[model samples]
Target: MTFSPTTLGTGIAGYNFLLRTRATQQAALANSPQVARDTEHFREKLKDIQTSDQLMEDRAMLRVALGAFGLEDDLDNKAFIKKILDSDLADSKSLANRLADKRYLAFAKAFNFAGESGPQLPDGKSAEDVTRDLAAIRTADDLLGNTSLLRATLKTFDLEGDIGNTFFLKKVLESDPTDPASFARRLADPRYAELAEAFDLSDKVKDRNTVYGFASVFADAAATLETPEDLLEDETLLTEALRVFGLENDVYRPDFLDSVLRSNLNDSTSFANQLEDKRYAALAGVFDFHEMAQAALAEEPFTSTLQSFVTTLNARSEPVTTSNDFFSDIKLMLETYKFFGLPSRSNQAGYVNRILNSDRSDPAAMIHGVTDGRYLALADAFRIEEPNTDRIYPPEFADQVVTNYLDRQFEISIGESDESMRVALSMERDLGKVIGNAKGNDSRWYGVMASNLLREVFETVFQLPDSFGTLDVDRQLKELKHRSESYFGTSALEDFTDPDRMEDLRRRYLMQSNLQSSATSSSASIVLSLLSRG
Candidate 1:
């Protein structure tokens, strides 16, 4: 059932055929014994490995591991790979940072044997799923065994980097938050106390939510401040606390306010007590550096809350899926939109209807045609035309790594057979992602130049010299910009968002590649003939 690339021949026609049927071909490959056995072996063995040495010890997993990041060539270079994996990422002179190809750095980050980013939830796990898992943790062993829950809790407190440091985590969770001299309190970072506050080690578990509401979340943050200066540094906490005490106008007068906050309210002559308005004393009382006053956090961040609401709107979004519930929901949605700063079509039901109905992924789709990046981000977030499953967690992170490995394996396989088709596949896969970023074209262009597969295709299609790659970064950017304008009449990556433009790019590369191959062949023949005559 294997569809060999040899049958497809070479150049533009073959490229077109392959592009049209790539999904099916990859599906077939995924099921084949060679691919299936290797992937299954890697999956089964991956969990046992927590270090680069362990990974390098297993050749089968190592193959898939390296293949995932297009680093398959380094299969024999385990020492070098291990060096990069263990290098101090903070040092610019480290082996990983010194390399021109960033794939090595990416490869190290993906494995994260050195705990570069700490722990995150495994990929594809929903928020609801995490909440359930966290609720189930009633003991120290339960907390340790469910690393996902542990990591999610840490992440909520912005302490995800300590994910691998399980021993330290156990000590923090087991400590009493009420005791200021305890392990959690002893840490200079107030986030640790916040962590200690959220978890009760005596089998009393609480729901951990990273989201903020002005009342309880701010109140919880207020209790954690050890100094008046600590209170001033956080704008969100400082502003909200000021508003609570009717001193919102004094936000700009930091030094004056800082002095006032430091004043002992216990003394009648204190700055806060002397103020005519009683609100100043109240502000000083709550923020006094003496004892901590804590509150619980409200569930859901603003974006997460907004996304959750949009999740409910997808089914009733399109015009054709009408129901009586839709009218009432639409009314609620308008207010929700206004609250979240989303652009809502208040009176324009027709426009809203089309946008809701349209496929955000399609260039011809109504939402995709919107000029505003905000609308695009909103539309993309909603996924109205398809499933909108949550992509968060300690749960999602593991699956994300696995998916990356397999997809990279697929890319590398195609590359081994035909490099042209490999580059074409990368463009088809990554073009939209690069263009969809809110960054300007120069940043996006660097994304192309950074990738060996992508840069080769663009250089070939635009007929840039091989020496163009040798130019300074700025000079190279200028060349890409100049060539892009000469060919496409625009230097913007956003202009290439359409699938048709990508295909056009593919066709150009294929045609030019074939021409180059033919000319090289002709020159080689002349040289051979001269050698024979001589």
Candidate 2:
């Protein structure tokens, strides 16, 4: 027999009639003690509706009611109602059995079963137990499926961007709900170990922010972290943190140093007091505020003295008009040098003899004889131009000499000499022909001259032997060559006509020269000491 909505409605009407009849019978027995007891029992059942046993009983009653409706052949309610309305059922028992089968099939389908005869839990396990297991399964699915929650969880350990990590996802998915140690095992995986250690997730972590704060501490360490576990397992993090705070080199008390870093960084008094600890006596040299201030104060006179020399040199009259004028300028510079406590009288006499005797037309001969340190210091101080090898001194030669003098003088005053600056100055002088040709034509001359100067500077500067042997000169040269090719192409100087190109070259040259200058210094103290001892 087939059932439709009409037949189901008729069944509902019959069920209502049965309820009314039962109500009438209960009313008739209302005065009886048994009826009152039954009523109280029914009220108790209503109150216990949320209980597992009550819920199970309610489900059973619902199944029975659906079975009696003659619409149990369909799994879906809408489909069943449609069938019921279209069908003509004459036998009530047959309809009830078919409806019961349909209702059973629907329950099986909803629970991922094939039919009424479906897989079930062991004898001791109830539907409630099955439901709890299903809930756990759903939770695991949600954890994997919901990207936001997954990202948030990873973010707590500074691993938010590792969402696509298959191993992490697999481990998370495999975590057992029943075993508390299961999650620990997954987190203990070496891949996630750093994160676990940083976040202190080995134990219960209540606040997400606390995990992030701890993670940040490790990330703030100097060396790159391979894994979160590296934060604790390796000395790299501790060493790097100590180095960053300037406590690495002289720190002798490891325990005390650790305590200080872990303390509040904002408390200057606490940090100052830590420095006073006798254990950190070595750091006293660096931390001595009074000594540092005194040293800084001591340099003021030297700085002022150098400034005065620069001003005097800048204000000196040009004395290269003739041999006699040049000699007069030299005498004046000698007196200035004497005033500044630079050249000895003998050195001055030697310089004068070299200048007077050397061919007046030959700058190279004149400078070649004036190689004494004292003479070099004085010549550099007074901004004296070096005579070019060419007999005739062009205006370009004068400019080159002035530039070289100023550069060397600056180096001397600072008590440092930069090999790169030396190379750059030499290269600038060597490129005199190229610079002379470009002069007075256009502003592009500056750019071309500057780029050529830098090209030679980098080439010569990078080629020089590294005093510290720390720089990878070869790699730097390769990178510089590549950058030069990319920025200026193969013919940088030849394309100097373009104003934009020239400007770019000028900017690049100045930037590189400035950077190189900072790293390079002219103080060959070790060599000088060796020479003095010899």
Estimate every model's Cα lDDT from 0 to 1: 0.62, 0.37
Runs in model 1 lying further than 4 Å from the true structure: 1-7, 88-98, 116-413, 428-447, 470-473, 494-498, 521-534
TM-score of each: 0.46, 0.15
TM-score of 1: 0.46
Evaluate residue 534 in candidate 1 and report its C-alpha lDDT on the 0 to 100 scale. 94
Model 2 / residue 465 / CA error / Å: 12
Model 2 Cα shift for residue 126 (angstroms): 99
Give residue 169's lDDT in candidate 1 (0 to 100). Answer: 79
> Can you write out model 2's per-residue Cα lDDT over 1-534, one digit (the tens) per residue?
111111111122423333345334334433345433433343334323332233234533222223222222332454443333323233344332245223332222222111222222212233333333322222334455656445644654456667887466545555443344665344544435443432333222222112122223443342333222333345644443334223455335555553443333234555533554322222222122333335466764222222332344334433232334445556445434543234356666555545544553575777555533334333322233343321111112222222232333332222223333333223333344343334442322233223434445445333434341344645544455455566567333445445566545434544555555444433466667789999
lDDT of 1 by residue, 266-333 (tens): 68898866876555555565454432222113432222222333334333423212222234576545
Query: Which 10 successive residues of model 2 have the least lDDT summed?
Result: 1-10
